[model samples]
Target: MKGTFPIEKFSHLSTPFYYYDTQLLRDTLFEINKEAGRHNFHVHYAVKANANNRILSIIRENGLGADCVSGGEIKAALKAGFPADKIVFAGVGKADWEINLGFDAGIFCFNVESVPELDVINELSAAKNMVAPIALRVNPNIDAHTHHYITTGLNENKFGISLSHLDQVLDHLSELKNIRLLGLHFHIGSQITDMDAFKSLCIRINEIQEHLYQRMLIVDIINVGGGLGVDYENPDRNSIPDFHHYFETFYKHLKLRPKQKLHFELGRAVVCQSGSLITKVLYVKEGVNKKFVIVDAGMTDLIRPALYQAYHKIENITSDKIEEEYDVVGPICESSDCFGKIVSLNQTQRGDIIALRSAGAYGEIMASQYNCRSLPKAYYSDDL
Candidate 1:
């Protein structure tokens, strides 16, 4: 709670907007950097997490690189003063223009997913008379044990190169003139709560690396892409993701060869706890044996709840009243736009300031205007 949203400060502004905790973000980055240094591992700040200019600047200042999923993200990272050499571009379907843009920017590497994608990058690099370094994003077929929608490393997830295609990938790599294969990449999923799932991922990665080393050589980097989730249930209890356990899991379980770098693309874990969607309660509707607290914010402002049925601890920052059971809803038209079902909060009233805790990761980055609602504005504590 960097300087406590200061309800008085926002009394003049709009009802719905994002308030950020830069202090928490700074502390999270410090922990990540400290832990990453212990194992000589590298972390790329996933741009899709927040992409707020201030957050990007703060992350870049801490020497964490950028993990971009789109051309716009790459541009935003560059505009925010992140060095081009520290950036990595990865996506399931990268357009031709995006590839050329990254190539031109001289980005660190492209986490190539499909075979056709590999060919396209090779062709593009050859046209530019350059050899592009790439990491083969492998579909490890391991259950991330998270949401089905966010699970990416499974065989059916439509994300990376399958295990069956490794031989073909090697053969194609030998033929491609402009693509240099350096490492293997795996991203199981996002917002994963189970540490055992990551341990299982490390086991799968070890087996895959052993199999690949036995067949082929020249592997250097082992990129276990980041899915270490934060405690959304108790944001105050744990503002920072368990970096100690996250890094220790890989340090203990992952088998790293001499001089090989381990890379992680941490997104939500690094920033989720430092953000909140500040909304004002518009009305309190009393119903049969139930109560409803409707806020001015909607699914358009923070879609994780409506889109993925995600949960966040909600608090009425302005009210000191006793607790009550209420269905926390948004101003959106659809029934699916509700934030929480039967959440327990203090007795609320009109104009009560509510903090949707742990929204820093996918909150501001996912704002939209589906119902012609103006996109939510963002404010930083360091500025205000």
Candidate 2:
């Protein structure tokens, strides 16, 4: 469904702020939990997607665990009422303090990416006289068929351990006594719409599991890191992703050993549709060759367009006048601050409220103050 924006309510509020549909967010969470529960699967909400306190609280209420990538995320998750045991820390570069924090918090697992990281965790765990539970993040080298910037499973990507070095990494396991190896982790990439990529990953996981079994390395968890894509262009049609098919894909293709638990670290698909970046038109400049609809918001408010050339469905919520094509550009100093090129919107005018849909994921969280812009404040649908 096309999202409803309270244009009257927004009239008094400042421009360049986020509006979150809490009902939509809760609905999405319910669907995710229902689907994952069917297969006895576990879900850890990736905090890197959107760490808004309200968003995190709603997710925690749904009983989904936290998939934290940093110490701050862990603290945020904990502060938001997510149980410490439900937190799983995963990052390629976990500093000394972060690793120690994870150990101190007693998180579910640390998705270890390298031998040196494993050693550091071991050392830190040994200091605390505790055994750190960890899962080796293996590089399956499975092509996720996504943007090169978001792809992480390939050997060239520095995110996970290469298959070639797995044997050597396993060999060091016995030498490191403070960390207990729990399972294997595989995150192919982000915004993966293709089921074939995940199917390939499942097959690769099977092979890897068999090899590990031969070596007597029995794992209890199989964390297929989540990269489920949301329909950015048609957020209304597919507001909630097909979680049933996503979970079933694994059930059908992945051969899980008797009692192994399946885990997912979903980020974008969880929060992307529930939010919209609301901006106000500053001017409608008529250039010689092109018309520009300049907005008050800039790359500082939402950088996905400039950073990834990402497309967000833009709409003129205030005006129902005849639509026209105009380049939707932001008021940033950089030339790359444009949101969309030749965008069709309601007959443009100054002071028209524009809603950039499918911006809930990486929009506000990634906002920077490059030009000393004020951080965007978030408003909730229920509150209004």
Candidate 3:
């Protein structure tokens, strides 16, 4: 089924823009709170997903914390009114300035990815005469069964510290006086639909906890990084992810210590379904074998289809004449600018408005100016 769009409003605006349903976003946040609150789990929205100013403000207003991977995202989160105590800085290569920025802001904790990173944070924190709170991002090596590019928990991925080095890292942590280990963090990958992967992550975390317990190391938080995937093909049917099952999987499998908090960094699942890449058909080219519907929006606006071979349900929202199949493409100079091959839609025309479903997560945030094209502007339903 097609998502509801403000066709009249879209017609008045420029082509190749993002249309966000704020009500749907709010509803999704409500479901996240309702489910996570059941287990008293703390959730921080991963700011790398969609960092639009208004979107960030709405998410902050909903009481969810922020999980940032860069200094700029931290600044954005702070500018949006998220409490400093509720933001967690995480990244593999955090510059010295970024670490200092975190210390200056007194952010909650840093998810340290390596022993060297730990030492750097320690040194930086010591320079400021402060104790830096940190969480060790351990690599559990669990396969998330997702795309290779997004899979981060494997031993080969350069994400978290390897399990084999955890003990050594812990031993080294004992020597650092300016850094305090606050928790453990794990993230397998993104767009994961399988609950077993998370269950596996829980089992691995339990084993790690037991090992830590043997060393009398009891941390205060267990942050199972978010990989909950939404239904991209059927966005209207499953607008919000299955948070009930996702959280329940952790509650049943993962064992938590008393007074220990469970944290989650969710990015895509929180915002993906409420957005669509709205573009106007620029031209229709008749090929020998098939027809092509060229859109004004290129890979610059939404690159997932070209980058990851990702699929987004395409619909001709302005037409209802009949059904036909056409290869939907963009006007980019590259051959990889295709959106969908042999996509079936209502008899499309040159001026029909097309809605690319489930783009709220990485759509506008990842837009580029590769072809010197202007960045797509975003319009929210509330304002429209």
Candidate 4:
């Protein structure tokens, strides 16, 4: 590592915790701000990926809005000091209380996924005697070019409203007095590496926008949901994603109307590389067929590996010995608890501090209390 981290100092106090490099986070945010400013784009940090209080505060300080998916998330964003006007609530199946909560909070707008959902919001807003502004999430049927599990823009997915139903939506728009359409929204998938997928989405958005404009629809906002992935295999080489390429893809392909503010809801790319999951080797066992390194940090601390078969660089930060092959695993009861199988790392021993790199996103935020484990505490470099 180019920068030194005092692993020895924290090894005595905790076996598993999240370590954040605030400097790297600031640099990533600066890149996002610089590029987004050039295009006059508005960004909302997707809180579903990572909502740690400190991390949320840092992201809020960057002046990006909060994209929340649930009622609890909206409450969390507010509790974290995100302005109501800068918060956007979205989900396919929002609860009645959740819609009422957003209505009371007066958030920016609800990203409505279905015509039925639109009716529900209108009903809720009508109950409160309030007009609710919304953006219709349009199903573009474009491939996200990522893992099959994450791709949501296809017709098979139950995410956004299909193009076949737009006529129905337009039919109801006149009747829904409490609902006001702001613009269109689209999100294909998460962790997409192919820039062409985004370009395809832009072309489709253009087609949709043109069709809507022909129907006398005035577009005020265009929300392209965030699914930008980051480099996990080589975290050292690419701590942050190429903001230039990402933004340029949109700038070149997306046809925008005058004064139409483009909104991006990014989560992973902004925070993934700046954090690491620090765990200590609880035991090292060598069997005839395999060598196993048991880590205190299980899938409970970071579930991306188990959930998405995701990869994060492993490092023996506290060891100086030669490398060896071992299957790094956590104490979880499930067979999927293995972090990496037959991975080569420094000759690890009991109590060696291990670091799982590129875990800044979907790491701590996805953590659960399974196996009766308490959530891991987080430490920032600024605090150290």
User: Per-prediction RMSD in angstroms?
Assistant: 1.5, 0.8, 0.6, 1.2
Q: Give one digit per residue, the lDDT tens place, for model 2 in 1-384.
A: 346888899999998999999999999999998999999999999999999999999999999999999999999999999999999999999999998888888788999999999899998899999999999999999999988899999999999899999999999987998988999999999999989999999999999999989998779999999999999889898889999999999999999999999999999999999999999999999999889999999999999999899999999999888889999999999999999998899898999999999999999899998888899999999999
* Candidate 3, residue 159: lDDT: 96
Off by more than 4 A, model 3: none
TM-score per prediction, in order, is: 0.97, 0.99, 0.99, 0.97
**How does model 1 score by TM-score?**
0.97
Instruction: Give the better candidate number (3 or 4) by lDDT.
Output: 3
For all candidates in order, the CA lDDT equals 0.89, 0.93, 0.95, 0.89
| Model 3 weakest 10-residue run by lDDT | 1-10
lDDT of 3 by residue, 5-45 (tens): 88998889998999999999999999999999999999999
For candidate 3, give the lDDT.
0.95
Best-to-worst TM-score order = 3, 2, 4, 1
Instruction: Please give the lDDT score at residue 43 for candidate 2.
Output: 97
Ten-residue segment with the worst summed lDDT in candidate 2? 1-10
* 1-384 per-residue lDDT for model 4 (tens digits): 422577767766676999999999999999999999998889999998888888888899999899999998999899889999999988899999999888888899999998788888888888889999999998899988788888999999989989989868877887999999887889999998889999999999998888888888867999999898888778888887988889889999999988888999999998998999999999999889999999999999989889888888888888778889999999999999989988898899998888999888889988999989999999998888
Error of 3 at 22 (Å): 0.2
For model 2, the stretches where C-alpha displacement exceeds 4 angstroms are none
Tens digits of per-residue lDDT for model 1, 1-384: 322567888787787999988998999999999999998899999999999998899999999999999999999999999999989899988999999999999899999998899999999999999999999999989898888999998898889988899888888888988999878889999988777888988898888878877885748888888988888887887778888888898899988877889999999998898999999999999988889999999999999988889998898888778889899999889999899988888889999888999999999999998999999898888877
| lDDT of residue 162 for candidate 1 | 88
After aligning candidate 4 to the native by TM-score, how far in Å is the CA of 301 from where it should be? 1.1
